[model samples]
Target: MAAPAVVRDLREHWAPASAQEFMLDDVDLGNRRLTIAGRVRPLDDLTLKLLLDWLEQRRSRWPNTANLHLLIHNQTADTTGRASSHWISAAMRGQDAPLEKLRVDRQLEEALPHGPDPLHLAEVFGLDEKTPMRYADSARALMERPLETDPATSP
Candidate 1:
């Protein structure tokens, strides 16, 4: 199946620290969903296909192991487990600025045009309501700025 433009772009440019770290379980794939930091979300078709491919490759390499963990360094318990945040951060260093920055920027950008609905932003981004409220305040401040061309019409 053809991937979406955004998915294709991400696949081509950004390689995660460990592809396995982002792996999903059979249940998740079956439902075409994901749960991150306790937030359940739907997985797009392209992402689900990519995940299945990765899982197949991993299974081929270690057919005897019973490890159900998505990401694994080795078949042994000592090495096989989830990837660390530090490792993920390091991997993202040269690829882009901190992942948090990218996430915040995307969130703020999305909030800006829509008048910054804190509840919506929080739900969509899986962030605390306060976080979105902070960005909403900033967006409101920017909107309050007086336009040079016509101060009365500004904001």
Candidate 2:
């Protein structure tokens, strides 16, 4: 509730109307990839492990349920529907950082390493063209900034 805008994507992700087939399309463990916005993003070992664990729990808790969503709560376990929007907010109520900040930080992290390749950043993070360019520019500026001189050490 504190950061409502930050959880907009979470709401959409947990929306009851989300296509079950897309959940399958989103993850490919064999290939270690995640598809977001039609972009195939590679999954690191840690992410794969966490996803596997979640999948195991989901299967164990709701083995008899018909819900096919990647994420579901008790309210949705018995049906093909998903958890409600309030559930999404409550789930993230005590998070250390806002989701939007995490997303921006991730983009900045990617941009800092490859500012010269805005296209790659855009593709990797599933971002629009301009956003990546802004990140790339900010990263380049940070990298190219001159170091401050120490008066005490001046010759």
Query: Which candidate wins on TM-score?
Result: 2
Residues 1-155, candidate 2, lDDT per residue (tens digit)? Answer: 23223124333222323322235447799999867556687765666776677677778977887776676667777878755545555645576876567667766776776665789877776667788788888788888899889999989
Local lDDT at 137 for model 1 = 82
lDDT leader: 2
- Residue 89's lDDT within candidate 2 is 57
Worst 10 residues of 1 by lDDT: 1-10
What's the CA RMSD of model 2 in angstroms? Answer: 5.3
- State the TM-score for model 1: 0.55
Name model 1 segments beyond 4 Å from true. Answer: 1-27, 44-50, 75-80, 109-115, 137-155
What is the per-residue lDDT of model 1 for residues 7-123, given as tens digits with 9 covering 90 to 100? 222233233443334444523877776665456656556657766775676668777655665654442324447644344334344655555666556667767888858876776
Off by over 4 Å in 2: 1-22, 146-155
Give per-model TM-scores: 0.55, 0.72
